[model samples]
Target: MSVWDGIVGQEPTVNLLKSVVASPGSGRDDIAQSWLICGPPGSGRSNLARAFAAALISPDQGLSDQPTRVTSQVLAGSHPDVTILSTNKVTIGIDQVRDLIVTSEQMPTTAPWRVIIIEDVDRMLERTTNVLLKEIEEPAPHTIWLLCAPSAQDVLPTIRSRTRVVNLAVPSNTAVADFLIRQEGVDRATALKAARLAQGHIGVARLYATDRQVLADRDELVIGLLGLRRSSDAIILAGRMVDDAKSQAARAVEGQVARAESEFRQVNGLGTDERIPPALRGAYHALGGKDEVRRRTTRLTRDVLDRYLNILASVYRDVCVLQNQADETAGLVNLENRPAITDLSVRLTRRAAIDRLETIATARRRLAGNGSPLLVFEALFCRLLVSDR
Candidate 1:
């Protein structure tokens, strides 16, 4: 019934946050003005931070009212008093951090506090974080900073020491299924299947439930591994995967680029398809509006590749579960691919399955380290080739 309702399987954290908002600045040194929310992917860390920011901005009526328009603005990241740096770029540049520091110094215009949220503080390079540590340590009385990362260890010790850490667990399968059903109006069967396939990732579960094509694509990718008997076949499959991931990334970027362009046009009172005059073209470049499209494309491609690799890893996870004779209801991730799971389990021993998992993990690391996708995936698939006789 509260704004925290959007957050799943985080009751203790929710209660702690509620208590904080209810009793702020009562000489409780434990209640921190700076927070670092750490969690696995798809655990809703960003959303939870937004809810907390909404409450901070309007503590008196925020939690109780389930977020009025002002708080909704906070969630949408459009509130005047709330500054969110949710970058899709690989690295959080120094300029963005400097801007946030300036914003943090500003007094709340219409809310109780000026809340600054950095979605992936771990993405910042060392020099950029050094530019922020001092400001984060001594913030204005009305300022609050909320930072998010995959885990506390991902951040530097100095940065970690200056903030209160909140760790979130991966949501349970039943919890994710229920969330999908409630949020997406999906039937129990669909919800359960997506929940299992997503391995308790709420956002991924929602995508699996609503998008038949997404489900089919993942299933096909897993099934394709069975047909890669030759090295050439593996290379071909890797190319297809790279192409698909890029296409998905491009589709994702198109909408965002369109929105940015639309805003650019609206700001200058130009028609949708109208050409910008030569003078105004420089203004667009000055705003970095011209480069945004390339940035969006680059960012989303990296993200899509990461996700595709995770999906590939999950296939081996399923095979491992089957080989071990684990609890079917709870342990299996790809329920719809049970046939493929069973087949892979029969083809590969437990050791072989685990080896493939390690291969996938290595591939992920290499990709993160800026390895070429076609090469990485080809190498991964060759290692993952069904060789257990």
Candidate 2:
């Protein structure tokens, strides 16, 4: 398949990138070296970046004779000349940027250009962005950087000014559903529900279609939120949400950390329970990569919490739609939760639903600012309780 085949609803972007890849030096200078791909969550920013990388590494021969091996290798991240830095951490540290900068200085070993992709560039701290500024501004002639962020504004203005911007919009529900049906062999009904529920997020729609448990959990969360009839119930539900998020986050990373630790021990010639003697402890610690693991865990936990909040927010949004008798054309994010939405709309005033949504937004802001999730959710629950009453 072509590198651009799977990217939905980005025909113009695909065409632009394809032309550049076909005749690299013929494109506008602005589109050559450094690119900032901006899109909302699930808009396939990273997918587009990888596609461009694949096309870049493929033989310069015409698109008809594209090197499938190079494209596959780039997609699978096995390409020696293409490096991807995708972090689950809260911030990309200065050390990470420095290492990437060092990599960028090296000439391409095999491909025509050395491509470095940094996904979620918005997650990098201001100081870390500053550290990367000079390297991105003055990269080696053979080096290219592809950075992905939710928006151009999310990146520092100086960095934003230096990179060519590619913006991707959310795909239509029909496009998402068609993709699921064609790619994953999902039935049309299931695909439509998943696509509608995911609000055009292809990844999430696939998950909703393939994972029955995810669909069930979303239903439970939506129904439970709507049925919160008392303050104690709100508090209990809030705690459950936080606990569930933490548990999911821990489960998500537990196996990854175990594998990393096992590989670290094997490389160090140590048993699972072995402890290094004082003299060799420095080497052992150096191999641990413990700080990186902890950082990933923290970041994953926060992300899971954010996802939980997003689900709640979607349910409330559905409530708003139902309360206003919004037309089907407006669409519902939680399509499967329509019964719950309708019930809540009838049982609660429109103002209460709006207030609850506001409370959730405030909780998200507090969480973003690194406030304690428990306190933030507790306050949110209190506010929601008061509003419902």
Candidate 3:
């Protein structure tokens, strides 16, 4: 199968990268060593970047013709000439950027070129990006940088101008559903419903299709928000919402940290729960042992909070659609909650639903900007309280 398989609805960007591989130097932009791939969440920017890296590293220089061994190596990010950096932290710091700069200067060891693929490049600190700008302005001949971000505007304009930017489109519901069917083996009915609810995010669509608990949790969050009748109840429920998200984020990363620590312990011939000597511990903390985990947990917590806010917004979004549309069945994101959404729509004006959506959006931005989660949600929940009058 082609490396691009399962990357839903990004044909133009895929073809552009393929052409770059097959016929380099045809255009200055075509073979540019540094490139930016930008798209919304679930647009497969990382997938495309890795696939392009694989094709570029392969001798055949084509997606379909890339040898299985070479393809697997690049995809797994184990290829000697390729470097992949993906951080779960909130921001990529100066030290990480400096290390990447050093790697970028190295000559290719085996493949014709050295490829570095960094996900979430926009999350790099501005100071760190300034440091990276010097190297990007004069990158080595055999080095190629593929940076993935949500948008060009997310990074500094100086960095944006230095790299060729490729934008990916959000896949359609039909395309997403089709991918679910082919990849996840879900039935067409489940696929379509999940695709609609996920709002064009392939990753979210997959979770919606495959996991019953996701839908249940989403329903609970949506219903809890809508059922708030008193200001006191809203504030109380808000606390629970914050706790739920933080808990989920904690559970999600605990295993990753555990596995990594286990492997490191095994390599150092230490048993599980064994304390290390002070000298050896230096190396461990230097590699971001406890500090990095704290940062990752914070980031994951914000991610879960964002998802909670998004799910709440979807309910109002459906409410707004039902209030405005000629046909109530069309254009609803949360089809599973139609009965409640329909009832809520009848109780509130269209303006009220829109206002609540705006409130949720504000909470989301505040959370991302490092606002205290409990306070933000408390304020948001109180504001979202529907009046009986």
Candidate 4:
């Protein structure tokens, strides 16, 4: 299979990347050492980066004897020349950038190019992003940096101005549904439902199609929003959302935390019940501190809340779509919740629905600023309650 086979949709992006890979170092300065892959969430920016890395690393481009094997190794993250820095945490720290900068100065171990792929570059703090600016702007002859972000606006002007930008379009619902059927063996009906609900996000569509708990949680959130009546109800629902986000984050990281603790104990030669030696206490604390655990959990909780906000936004978006009687051919993201959407459309005007969407957007911005989700969501729901009435 070709290096780009796994990427669904994005034909233009695939062709452009393939051309660059096929004719690397032919004096085509447009394909620079640093590239920014910009797209919405779930547009497969990371996937595209990995595929390009595979093609660059392979001796024969896309015609290697084991092209599929090369691509698989890159995707599985076993390729030595291809370095991927991806994190589930809320921010990418400066320390991480320092380590990658060290690698960037080195020569390739095996492949012709040493490719560094940083997923979610938008999550890096301004200081952390500045650390890599010089390296990305003036990398070694064989070094290439691939940075992925949700949009161009998320990146700093200095960094963006020095890099080549590759924009990726979100896959249509029909495209996403077909991909699920071919890849995950999903039934057409379920695939279509998941695709529409996911709103062009392939990962979310797959989860919504396969995971019953996710489906149930989405239904509950939408229905709960529809049933909000009074300020008291909004306050109560806000608490529930905060609680749910916390629980979801905790569940996601419980396994990783357990494994980390186990590894730390093993490396430090301490048993579960053993007390730390007085001399080694500092090392132990540094390796497995409760503060670190709390920080990681907080980041995960914020990320979960971000996802919840996106889902919440989709509800109002669907309501607005129904109120306007938008294109008949295009389906709603929350098609399963059409009855509730119809009811909301009848009760609230299109302008009210638009205002509700804006409230959700404001809530997201507040949450990103380290504000409490409980308070932000409470205020948002109260505003939405007024709009609904």
* Highest-TM-score candidate: 1
Error of 3 at 164 (Å): 1.4
| Superior candidate under lDDT, 2 versus 4 | 4
- Write model 1 residue lDDT over 241-344, tens digit each, in one string: 88877877677667665676678899789998799989888766554454776777766777767877788788888787777777455476666667867887
Candidate 3, residues 69-146, lDDT tens digits: the string is: 877888877888889899877788889888888988888888878888889998888898899897777788788999
Cα lDDT of candidate 4 equals 0.83
Q: Candidate 1: which pairs clash?
A: none
Error of 1 at 129 (Å): 1.7
> Tens-digit lDDT track for model 2 on 124-201?
988999998987888788889999999999999999999989999889888889889989998999998888888877
Question: Which candidate, 2 or 3, would have the higher lDDT against the true structure?
Answer: 3
lDDT of each: 0.82, 0.80, 0.83, 0.83
Cα distance off (Å), candidate 2, residue 208:
1.7
Query: Which of candidates 1 and 4 reaches a greater TM-score?
Result: 1
> How are the candidates ranked when ordered by lDDT, highest leading?
4, 3, 1, 2
Which regions in candidate 2 have their CA more than 4 angstroms from the true location? 24-31, 60-67, 254-297, 346-352, 386-389
lDDT of 3 at 292: 73
Worst 10 residues of 3 by lDDT: 22-31
